[model samples]
Target chain A: MRFSEGTHRLHWATAPLRAFVFLIVYFVLLGFPLLLTQTDDGVRLELSAEVAVRFLLVTVPMTAIAVGSGLWAWLALRFRIDGDDLVVETGLLRKRRRSIPISRVQAIDLVRPLVTRVFALAEVRVELAGGEQSEIALRYLGRRSAQQLRAELLARAAGLPGHTPEAPERHLWRVPFGALLGSLVLRLPVLGAALLFFASLVFLVMYAEGGMLAVAVPVLLGLIRAVIAPMVMYANFTVATSPDGIRLRYGLLETRMQTLPPGRVQAVSIVEPMIWKAIGWARVEVTVAGYAGERQALSSTLLPVAPRHVALHLVSQVFPGTHIDAVPLLPASSKAVSVDRADGAGTDDVVFVSRHGWPCRRTDVIAHARAQSVRLTANPLQRLLGLATVHVDAPPGPVQVAASDRDLGEARAIVESTARRAQAARRAGGDPTHWAAR
Target chain B: MAAPPVYRADQAFAPGNGLRWSPNSKRHTWHRLLAAALWAVPVGAVGEFIVWRNGGGPVAAAMWIVAVVLGVVLAGTVAELDRRSLGYAERAEDLIVMHGVFVKRLIVVPYGRMQFVDVTAGLLERWMGIATVRMHTAAAATDATIPGLPAAEAAHLRDRLAQKGEERSMGL
Candidate 1:
């Protein structure tokens, strides 16, 4: 279907612009009448005219500044893609124009708020590999339009293809939800933020706004986000598989839909927060060519929620040679050493509590890192307890699936030993291609 | 017919040619720093002139002028270092960059990965006989640039890289 061809227009996305115009109108019409009113004094107030004129003078420039600023911003973000180049024509006064050839286009990512998503629209980001030049977005397109744009743009970069689609040759693994939420919330600075907001409100009430108003403002905003947190979260995240790429959709206000092909992914990590340990949840992230450490946005996440056991199967599908599901799990009778050292809790025996802690649930889980590079991390207390978290980094990037609190030298050794076996098996013609071979 | 393997200056020709010889690369370090310093001077002059004329005394004027000069000199020096430090690698498929200090990095981004690459020669860069090489990925997340590439080499590299990507992707 033919649709409007472009990013979110400046006039359309700048919501506050109309209000600014209204403010100018309001100041002139209403404030003018108020400022220039004849005083009750018998003498007609001459300054009334002056006051009205001054206000008018101030309003005109303020109005101009508001509208001008938005316009300038729009000018700074003028983007259009031509057959030859993905052109970024941005400037305030100088007219800075940049053209990125389509051949160089590597990936296109989408981002925006759920409101945009609710409208079935999002921002389309254009990226080239190795960081030459790329465009952040061609926004306000409906999902279909955005996808079409992305596909066409990518096809342009891919060049008229006579060759087959060249996605990576492997299935994708998904993480568990319980694990995702646990890690997300645990990492969230909610407590500190709540405390700070509380203090700010108190200060505002006690020192500035006084009493009810100050208290009301902070509490009101806080309560709203608290309520919104789960609701936004519910509609927040979704990841999917597409060709040789992974598509991730996330965000509350700024909804982001990103795609990372296997070629782009540099590393992959799976994190299970304390919360997921109870029900068994996990979150998976990848590292890509352009995207580096910490910001997992560059990579794809397998699952926001899943069962601990099911994780292996999902992983096996996504990343070849990463099939924990195919690998055998050992029971307690097996001689894998306990690596966990929680407080008085020792690795010899793990205490699995059903509930109550921010990660909120508890269970002892240990997965050996796929052996590529050896990494050992220890917290101050873990060190005191003579324990350190160790993971064997795997290629692609390191995959640290599980960790123990204390030093699990023996456990690490055993897992490495098993990893060797897994590696051997992979090398010995375990054709994962059997499942999804092109 | 097998396509003549397309190449960017960074990726074309030399085995270790990619180790440093990027196509179309000249050097932008001096020009950018010069521009910044030139821009800063007028700003500092204005501020100092204002204070001096406003009766803050010659000391304030002198101080402002000194500050502006120092800032420009320091910034220019730093830019020079950055320009001198960069090296490029070119191969048939991709442009490899071994750039940066304190954080020595090797970036091997395939032509397929490049969203687009721009070979630019501004007035000052033109005067210096240099060009800027910039490339992007589809994601638009990380942008890589080789500033101050020799203009002649840059045009050739840009054309070659662009041509290569076009043959493969059908994009600009």
Candidate 2:
């Protein structure tokens, strides 16, 4: 379908779905009192005078207003692709017209929440490179249209002409469900919560008390967030690569497909938690420019959990042709023993890598061309120890590249060398615009 | 004592690299003092009021006097140190900003990575004829600020930096 031809409205399903979502709590609350009226004769449809009045005066009108407004908003909402921008017009009384430049498009994500998924609809979120208010979402598009639109937007952003077929993705890896579950359970918080949960359960059984129930509830909630939520989110997590960039597909209840175009990733970090270290498991995260908002949590995650070698291999793939092992690592100076015992930093022709953190060892890798700035900092204690920290700045995200508590001289050297490397890399860097075209 | 180790002169970020660092305007000192006073006066007044209302007699007044004197002395010293510490240098490919006393920092932001340059002056700063020049890169953590330049200088620096940024524009 030609997106630039004319304006288009959202799917008709949007009206009812939006109304249902808005009144879900109201529906539940109304159903609850009805359920309480159940008896041996079965739930009677007898409504009390007060509830019946409320149903007529409040619930009926509220539902009508919700459905009416949803339908109105749907009617008012119209989006079309202009010459080089996606123009969205919405609202009736207070109209809003937003035109997002295709050139500044960072990443386009397709999200399918459970409700939307049930209706075979999806939400298309377009991320632009700027501050907080940089995301634009077009909700309740048909799943197929959402996918096609995402591909089209990506192709345009990559400076491809016409409706180019998406570059064929080569499957790289998929996180096994068992491994994901195991990894989540092995986490410190999850393990602690599990222990507390069992202890509380034992206490509740040993002595029938309400106090232990409170502890049990919170512990169970923590366990759910730490384990079950991630299990559902990262279920069937898959990674792939193509000429356009890297693609990630994951989620069970709410599916998400994120595409990171070439050269967009500012930095990558490999993390190995203490328990995961024993099992030789690791997680990889990256810092992408323009992902500084709510979507940052999942978008930054390159790999949720994988074997050590797989994580390293993925890192190498993220920044092609660079090998982590090939770069000679320099151990932190002995003078920094007080601050960091087992930490080191290294650099190669293409990337600067720093390994730090005690229980959870994190190795941050920033491509020379991607480095925005380099910093050398020293506190009084560090000054006394003749130690300083060299920090490589990228856009705001999870990946922090810092070589902390190094000898002052080494820190200074790192800063100078990194800056020079960044300058040289910038000179040779590929055109940021029209990435695929180049 | 033995002579200090002679590091390479080409180290751009080295503290003693002989770069011609431009200090903030002299009026910045007064501006900082006034700003500090603006904060301290109200805070100190509230604190003194709380102490007096609690029914402590002359002791509260004496304590406040000591506190005020100590605060002024500390603020004055800090203001001087801060004035001495803040410096920025425009180099061949990047701008370097150095500041802080107890915790010294030197940040080098490449011109090519700068998204924009912002020049701002608060009411107090405008009154004092001083402004701040902030160089923003795509990276939010790039803390490149020249906080106390004369108004004209700040504008000049902002324009020059903006021009350089455009010339060396490397999109993120």
Give a tens-digit lDDT track for model 1, residues B52-155: 77899888888888888888888877776665556666665556554543332334445544556788777888888988778765333233577777788778
> For residues A22-75, could you state the per-residue lDDT of candidate 2 as single tens digits?
677766776445434455897666667865775667677779877997789789
Task: For each candidate, give the interface RMSD after superposing the true interface residues on Cα.
Answer: 17.7, 4.5
Per-model TM values vs. the true structure: 0.44, 0.91
| Model 2: colliding residue pairs | none
| RMSD to the hidden true structure, all candidates | 14.7, 4.0
Q: What value does the lDDT take at residue A327 in candidate 2?
A: 87
Residue A27 lDDT (model 1) = 71
RMSD of model 1 against the true structure: 14.7
Candidate 2: regions farther than 4 A off: A23-45, A48-60, A203-214, A338-342, B1-18, B38-63
- The lDDT values for all models are 0.49, 0.83
